[model samples]
Target: MPPVSSPGLLDGTGALRTSVEERAARVRFRRAMALMVMTLLAPGSAQLVAGNRRVGLVAFCLWLGLLVTGFVALVVALVVALVHREWIFSMVSNPSLLLVLRLGLIAAAVGWAALFMDAWRIGQPLSLRLTHRRAVVGVNGFLCLSVMGTLLFGAHVVGVARDGILTMFGSDEVVGAHDGRFNVLLLGGDSGEGRWGLRPDSLTVASIDAETGRTVLIGLPRNMSSFPFRDGSPMAEEFPDGFDCDGCYLNGVSTWAQDHEELFPGSEDPGVEATIAAVEGITDLEINYWAMVNLEGFKDLVDAVGGVTLNVRQPIPVGLPHEAHFHYIDAGVRKLDGHDTLWYARAREGSDDYSRMARQKCVMNAMLQQVSPQVVVRNFEKIAQASTAMVSTNLPASELDTFMDLALKARGQKVSTLSLVPPMIQTADPDIPLVHRKVEQAIEQAEGGGTKAAGGTGRKPKATPDAVTGGSIGSLSEGYAANQAEDLGAAC
Candidate 1:
C-alpha cells in the first residue's frame, strides 16, 4: 500500500512534505528568536533590520542619545527640583560631575554589552536547529548579562558616591547662615594612643533655623569653665579673661590649640580652629560649622544606622567601673547596639556630665527621629562607610544640599534643648551672662517665641517612679529631662 505514494511526494492526507532545506531550517529558527527580541527591544533594532546599516546607524544614534539624555535629565531634574533647589544639590555634589557620571556608566555598560553581542551576530545562528542553536545561545546570554549587570551596578554606585564626596566634604570654604541661624559646632572627639590632639568630650551646638528648620540643641559642658574668645580671636589673643587657666576646660580648647601652633599662623586645623574660637565665645553664636565626632569611630556610626532606639531609663552602664568587663544596658524601650549606644551616650559610672548631657540629648533625639529618609536610602553604602571613618568637618561640599534640606526640615519640627548643666548654668563658673541668656532664649523659643523655652521652668518635675538617676530618669540635682527640653521627644 505505501508503494503508491509519489504524486510529488504525496499531499492531500498523505505524508512526507516539508523539504526545501527543511523549510529553510524552520525559517532560520524563527529568525533566531526575532533577532534576539530585536536586540532586547530596539538596541539598534537588531542591527537595523538584519545587521550593519552603518553599524546600525551608529548604534541607533547611541541608543537614541541615551534615551534623549535620560529624558532630558528627568526634565532637568524636575525643573531643578522646582526652580533652584540648591541647583539640584549643586549638580549632585559635582566631583567633576561625579567623574563624568562614573565614566558615563562605564561607557553605557560596555556599549550596551556590545549591542547584545551584535544582535547575536545578526541572528544567522548557523542556520539554526541544534536545539535552535542552543536557544539562540541562551537568549544572547541573557540579554548580555542583564544589560551589562544593570549598567555595572550603576557604575559601582557612582564610584561609591565619588569616594564619599571626596572623603566627607574636604571643604572649599562656604560658610553663610549666621543670625538667621546655623551655628553647628558638635565635637565629641576623644582621639587615641596618648590622646593629645583631639580632646573635646562632646560639646554640641546645632542651632539650625535658617528658614524654619528650627533645631536648637546647645548642650556644651565638657566641664565648661570660664569661657570667652571670639573678639579679635586667636583664642581671643590667648584667652583674654576667660578659658581660666587651671586645666582650662571647654574640652581643653582643642588641647590648647594643638599646644600653641604658633597661635594658628596659617592654620590647617589648629585644633579645629581653636575649637571654633571656643564655640564662638561660649555661644554668643556665629560659628557656622565644625562636626568632629570620632568617639571611637562612634561605634561604626552606630553600627551603620541599624541600631538606635533609646529610652533606656535605667540600667545603662557598659564599661568604666574599673571595667573588668563590666556590663548592663538593661532597662526597657530597647534597640541598643553599637556597644550599647556607645555606653548609652558615654556612661559615666553613676552618670553626671549632666547625666551624660541628658543622654546626649536622648541620642540626638533618637538619631533625629529614628533616622528616616528611608533609613537614609536604605543604609546608603553603610552610611557612606561609617561617615568616612566617623566624621571630621569644615562642612562645605557646597553645604551638602543645604544640610540635606535642613535635615528634612528638622524632621518635622519641635527639637529645642539647652543644657549648660547644673541647676541651670554653672559648669564651674559657666554663668556667662547665664550662658548668653539661655542662648538667646533658646533662639527665641526656636524662632516662634514663648513656649517657656530653655527647659521650660514652668514647673513639671514630679514623675519619678523608677527613680533611675545616672542612666537618667531624673535627679542629677533635678535636671535631665533630656537636659533641657521644650519637647525633645517629650523629654525622652
Candidate 2:
C-alpha cells in the first residue's frame, strides 16, 4: 500500500473525530436515561421508610414526561440541523425554546433536591427516627407553604371566567404626576328593598398616595343631609316610589328627583352627581373614582377571604324582625363571616356607626392578618372567585397590575385608622365639621398632604374660610340649643 498522503491523513482524522463525537453523544444519552430510571425506582434521598409509591410514581411520571418532551424536541432540532446543514438556524431556534427547556430543567432539579432532602433524613440512624420524622414533617409543610405563596400572589391578577357584573371604566392610561394622590368616593346606600340587587351600605373615602403608599379611609355617615347632589335636585327624590320611610333614611340617591312622581316613578333613582359633589366637598379632594358595593357584596368579600377577624368589645345583634338574624360578634377576638361583617358594620344602634366604623377597621385588619402564605395558597381558587363578584372599582384592568404591585409592596406597612366622631367633630355638628375646611384640612394632613404635616400632629390650623363655614358650626357665638340646631343641621 502507498504511504498515506497528507490529504488522506486529514480526511481520516476528520472521520475519526466525527465518530468520537457520535459515540460520546450516545454515552451521554444512555447515562441520562439510566439516571432517570434510577431516580424513579430507588429511594434516592427520599424516605422509602414512609413512601406512598403510587403518589411518588405519578409525580415521577409527570416529571419524566416533561423531561422527555424537552429532550425529544432538542434531538429533533439537532437532527434537522445536521440533515439540512443549517447549524446556524438550529442554534438560533434553540434559544427561542430556552424558557420551556429551562423550566423542565428546573423541575428536574427541584425533584432531585426533594429526593435528596428526604434521603438525608432517611439515611439517618434508627435512633434519629423521632427527630427525622419531625424534620420530614417540616419539609412537607414547607412544600405546601411554597405552593400557597405562589397562588395568593397570582390571585390578584387572575380573574375567573364567570360573568361578574362587567363594570367597565376608562382604559388605564398612566399620566405620571408627582405625589400622585387619588380620591375614591365610596358610597354606602341603605336600600330598604330586601334582596334588591346592590346598594352601598357604608360610605368611605379612601385617599391613596401613590408615591408614599399611604392610605386613609374616611367614613361618611349615610344619614348626612346637607350634601345636596350638585345637580340641584330635591333630597326626597329618592323616595318617589312611595317607600315607607317610618324610620329608614331615604337612600342618598333618591334626593335628585325632589320626590316628584313624574320624574322617577316606582323605583328610587340614584343621585350620582349629587353623591359625587357631596363626597368631593367633604374631602376637598377631587374624586377620581367611585365604587359601590352593597351589603351582600361586602358579605361575599368577607366570606371569600374566608371570613375576617374582629375584636369585639361587645355583642352586636342586627336585623329587624323579618330579616336574617345575625350576631356581629361577642367580646374579645372573634371571626366574623361576610353577613356578620356587614351587620357588624351596620350596627348603628349598637354603637351608632362610630363604633361600627371601629368594627369595620377591625374587620379590615383581621382580613389582612388572615392572608397568610398558607391561607393564600389553600384558598387561591376562592380568593380569585370572590374578587370577581364582590367588588367593583373604576380601576381599569391595565392599571390593576401596577396598583396590585404597589399594594403588595405596601402590604406590611403601617396603616393608621381614624374616625372623625364626637370630640373630633362636635357633639352638636358632626355633619357641619365634616364638610368644614377644618375637617378637610385634618383629612388632608392625615393623608400626608396640604399644609398639615404627615400624620398631622401639632400642625398650625389653616384658617378655614369663614365663607365655607356658612354659620354651620352652630354659630360659635350661640350657646347649647343653637349649637344643637347647628349640630342637627350639620349632621343632617
Candidate 3:
C-alpha cells in the first residue's frame, strides 16, 4: 500500500493473469500436438504436409529408430520361441512388471511429447508478426516429421500386434528343407466356417523351387468344373445330393465337407485333398504340398507386410456383391491394404472368374515381391502368428525354420502365375467344363519337356483334344494366356 504507485506494477494479479494465459496456451498446444499425431498415424498420409518438414523429419527418424528396435526385440523373442517351439502369446500377454521400467518409459514418452510441444510453439509466434516463408517452411517441416514418425510408429505397432516371442510351432517341430521344391495349394476359403464369416474367395496353388528359387502359381476359378470326387452318385452331395455336378464346382467342395462332417470330423482333409486332386488333374501338375487359408488370413498377411504395392491394371471399386459376377476396374498402379485387397481380389465385375483369377495372381506377385529378406527377418514372428489360424500347410513345423531360411535366400525372385480358363483353354459352356487331355499336356509342360509337345514349335501336340475348339487345343496354357497374362514375367 505504501508503494502502491501503480497497481499494475505491484499487484500480483497481473502476474497471475500472465501465468494463466501461459498455462492455457501450453494446454492448447499440447492438445494440438496430440491430435496431430493421432491424425497423422491413422489410415492415411495426408498429415505429412500439416506443418514444417524439419520437425517432421526428426520425428520420423526417431520413430523409425524405435520401430527398428522394437522389431529386433520381437524378432529375437520369436527366434527363441522357434528354437524352443513355444506359443507366441507367451510374450504378447504380459506387460513388464517392473514399476521402474514402466515409469521410465512413461517419462520418456512425456519428455518426447514436451519437446514436440515446444517446437510447435516456436513455429507459431504471437507477436502479430506477418506469416513469412521461413515460418511456413518450419511449420511444414515439423508436420512432415510428425507424419512420418506417426506412420513408422503405426507400422511398429502393427508388427507387434501381429507377432510375439513364443512361436506357434515348437522348437522340436520347426525344420527347414534344402534343395526341395514344394507346391503349396493356397486356398482362400470363405465358407462361413470358424471365426471368419465367409467361404473360400480365392484358391491358388504355388510351386516354389528351392534350387532356382523360382515360384509358379496356378489359380483355380471357383466355378471351374472337373474331376468329380469318386462318387458317380452325383457331385452335389453337399446340397441334397445333385445340387450341381458329377465334377464338383469350386464352392461345392466346401459344402460337401460341411455336410459330411459326421463322416469326416477333426479334419477337412478329404474335401481339400479332393480339390487339390481336381486342380492337379486339371493342370497335370502334382501338388507337393498345400496351405489352406481364408480371406481373413489373407487380410492379416497383407497387413503384416505393411501393405503390398501392386500395379493395379484397374481401380477396383467397393460395395460389389461377393460373387462370380463381373465387375470393372480402373487401370493404375497403387498400394492396397487389407480392405482394398479383398475388393481387388474379388472384383470380377465387367468380367468373369477368369479375370478374377488374374487379379488374384497379381496379388500373389505383389506379395512375393514385397516379401524381402529384411521384411522376413523383421516380420518372421508376425508372419508365423498371422499364419496360425489361416494356414493349414503340409510342411511339418520341424521343417518350418529351414523353409524360412531357404525362402529368405530366394527373396526377390520371379514367379510365374497361370490360370485355366478361356482362350488358353475353353469350356463347353463359358461357365463350366473340365479339362482332361489339355490339362495333361500343360502338366507335362510344367514338369519338364511336357512343354515341348504342347509349347515348343519343334514338337507336335502331346495328344489331340477329343473335340477341338476352333483349331486350338483347349489346353490350360490357352486358358491362362487368354484370361490371365497380366505382367507375365515381371519381378516384384
- Top lDDT prediction, candidate number: 1
User: TM per model?
Assistant: 0.39, 0.50, 0.51
Which clashing pairs does model 1 show? none
A best-first ranking of the candidates according to their TM-score comes to 3, 2, 1
Each model's lDDT: 0.79, 0.47, 0.51
The CA lDDT at 406 in model 2 is 44
Please identify which of the two predictions, 1 or 2, would achieve the higher lDDT against the true structure. Answer: 1
Candidate 2 C-alpha error for residue 490, in Å: 29
- Per lDDT, what order, best first? 1, 3, 2
Please provide, for model 1 over 1-492, each residue's C-alpha lDDT reduced to its tens digit, 9 standing for 90 to 100.
455554347665767776777778888888878877776676777788888888778877888888898999999899878866767767877778888988988887787788888777777787676988998899788878988898887778767777888887897888788768888888887658777237878888889887768798888888787778788878888778988888788787787788889988998889888877887787788887888877877787778888998878788778866868788988889998677798888888776778788788888888887888788777777777778877878787878888877877788888978877777777778768777877887678678665674345333344568555887667766677777776788877
Candidate 3 lDDT score at position 181? 57
Question: Predicted candidate 3: what Cα RMSD to the true structure?
Answer: 13.2
Higher-lDDT candidate of 1 and 3: 1
For candidate 3, write residues 6-61 as lDDT tens digits: 43243643452335545655655544445445433521111244554565566666
In lDDT terms, how accurate is model 2?
0.47
